[model samples]
Target: MTVSVAHGTARLSAVAGATAGDAYVRAREALTAAGLSEDDIVQVVEYVTDPAAGCGEARPAGVTVSTVAVEGLPEPGATVAVEVTAYRGGGERIATGSGVVTVADEIVYVPGILPADLSAGFREQYRSCLEVAGELLKAAGLGLDALVQTTDYTATATRAEYPHCGRPRRELLGGTGADGRPVHPGAAGILVDRPLTEGAMVSLDAIASRRPLRTVNPGWRRYETLTYKPGIAAGNTLFMSGFGALEPATQRAIFDGDLLAQAEYTYAAIAAVLREARLAGNAVVRLVEYVTPAGIADYDKVAEIRAKYFGGPVALTSVVCSALLRPEFLIEVVPTAVFP
Candidate 1:
């Protein structure tokens, strides 16, 4: 069983020792209690302590389940800690995220459905991923255009295989963004290299969107338009998505070899987003830091940089991975913010 806490319109569910059966039952109960249909539940963010149960079960309709692991949660006896966040309309839901500093807006919008059972075949499954994304956007009164960021996780994926896995989804939304075309906000591929279940291939997630706008000296990036939705009025908001820390001349990270340097690049990149949004240093809300092996070595430096740039209260999450998209790029950042 699980306890829930809801305040200021934020709904949170915490359950321990949850099985797939428990999630199903809870979904039914929650909808009934909330005066909403089962369809109202858009996504489930499950923190699985024991992966043996396989992260509970498939997601119900209009719902997508994202799995994560926490050091401790629910209770001592709890093998699994699960939380279900119900979005009435275009609220934000962070789906399966990984990185050093996780920002508020970095949370991807996931529809209600089991990831493994997303579709019948990878081709159809791939299309389904885009279709689900479209639905989530529609619910928020945004179109595929609102899809500003994307992280695709697949098994043994390569540049050659990206077209096959990612092209269909991109085509459905718009087209590829490789050459300054209207691409799907930010798109990148990750190599999972692990076997997953059915309907599960290329697990993807996204950030909430705001209509884009152009600004003169929006106070940040020189040549970028800034647009994003706030979590709450006078509260924190989404900063930017998929900003890299590469040297303009070499098109590589300014501090490629050192983790602390890579961490520095991430902080600097996030600054650009804040500038574009016309936000100040104080308005910076959250951080999602991504680092390769080299960056992991200097984890303490990464923490130090974070303390320097974002001194105020903030939410953060980080991840150490084998590599990032660029060889010379050791670190990257995605940020979210709110204003007082």
Candidate 2:
């Protein structure tokens, strides 16, 4: 087990099979070990067996649902999983990029996100996230053009299944300009996955700055914005929104039903986003990963991925739980890129 803490965030990488209740207690313990408090911890991420499935009558005790996605992983059974990431201090210093987007000015969550009924998934989930991102930009008086980076999440999107999901995403955020003009492409990163749910294909989180778009990338293969966020904040510091393990082209999950593959795609996407943002792999200074119980056994693999890409000494946290959008998505990644 390795733990690192910095910038008001705590990262714990451990290999232990624990139930939901146990993972909750361990989260508190990890916080205490880092000299942090529960109140200071804004979110709780965990990887535990599905309380409703594997545990069944033997479900752990005292696990209150602050946030939960019960069916967000591989088949519910004895699966070893690795997880990493977190947002500390209620994510105060790290302002919501969506909060600053001028165009996406509101946060609306449609409870019944039916993948089959994409209107709800797109309008309420996909479009709503962009709306929030746009709102964040709008609050800062910057149009959607000011945005340089973005990350998306979905619970159960596959290549065959994502086209239907991407339809609304493309229409709403595909190429619309800040002034309501049509652009060639839109958004920075689109990550989706498969979890246990019906028609819950999208749940996105993003990070951007009120700063100006200064850096530009010559490599124009990317369909979306070359920059991840607008402006260079206090030097080239890149704060990323939460991302997951979906194949970029189809917008479907790459891992199928594997946490390891999920983590790999996630790290790969982070690396791609960093490079696209003109930052190095090591620029990943902070990470917050969401995991499910099915992935708890392979905790080492998550650490390995971080160590491989981010190197040693970056702050990370692994939370055991479900994704808001899909049930089979075992991992979702949130990263911060900082340059020297």
Worst 10 residues of 1 by lDDT: 226-235
Question: In model 1, where do residues sit more than 4 Å from their true spots?
Answer: 1-53, 57-64, 68-108, 112-128, 136-142, 155-160, 163-170, 174-189, 195-201, 209-236, 248-250
Q: Residue 239: error of model 2 in Å? A: 3.9
The local lDDT score (0 to 100) that residue 322 gets in candidate 2 is: 34
How far is 309's C-alpha from truth in model 2 (Å)?
Answer: 4.0
Best candidate according to lDDT: 1
The sequence of per-residue lDDT tens digits that candidate 1 reaches over residues 27-128 is 457556755554444445554444346753354532455554333332345545445545445244333322111122323354332243454655666666
Model 2 TM-score? 0.51
lDDT of 2 by residue, 1-340 (tens): 4555444344455323435444445555665676665445432223333422332232222221112233333334423223323334433322332211111111111111122334464445555555555555544454544444444444333434443535555544433333343332223222334332445555443434333334422233333433232222222455554566655556565665687888887787777767766677766665656665566678566777778888867656445443324445767766755655
Model 2, position 161, has a per-residue lDDT of: 47
